[model samples]
Target: MKAHNSKKVIQYSYLFHKIGILDDEQYKQIEEYHGLKEKKKY
Candidate 1:
């Protein structure tokens, strides 16, 4: 179960990064919907 969860996290993280959807504006929109800000690297 733990491994499965980790895999899912990694998969989604890769998908997000590949799509270039990690900018400040998109992050804010995601935060507004999900109720928390994501830690950004750039």
Candidate 2:
């Protein structure tokens, strides 16, 4: 539905803006940490 898709777009934009505040180094570190956690879980 159009409304459902619009809601998803808003959520994605919100997340993007939230992460946009972080510097690239911080983002990469967070990503790496999550990757390690995922590997451990598997």
Candidate 3:
């Protein structure tokens, strides 16, 4: 469930960024944070 939600979040974040809702920094922040968490778990 968590992993699924994380994927959705990343997808949405990218979509938002692509559509001009989120900037590069904001998108990268979210992506990096989740990437770190996933790394820590694995």
Local distance difference test, each candidate? 0.50, 0.57, 0.86
Model 1 agreement with the true structure over 1-42: per-residue lDDT tens digits: 544554465556556756885765664454443332222211
Model 2 Cα lDDT, one tens digit per residue, 1-42: 544554465555556657796556765665565556555655
Against the true structure, whose TM-score is highest?
Answer: 3
Tell me the TM-score of each prediction against the true structure. Answer: 0.47, 0.51, 0.83
In angstroms, give how far residue 9 of model 3 lies from its true place.
Answer: 0.4
Q: List runs of model 3 lying over 4 Å from the truth.
A: none
Q: Which stretches of candidate 2 lie above 4 Å from their native place?
A: 1-19
Model 1 sits at a Cα RMSD from the real structure of 8.4
Candidate 1 Cα outliers beyond 4 Å, as residue runs: 23-42
Better of 1 and 3 by lDDT: 3
Q: Between candidates 1 and 2, name the one with more favorable lDDT.
A: 2
Q: Supply candidate 3's per-residue lDDT for 5.
A: 73
- RMSD in Å for all candidates: 8.4, 9.1, 1.0
Shift in Å, residue 31, candidate 3: 0.5
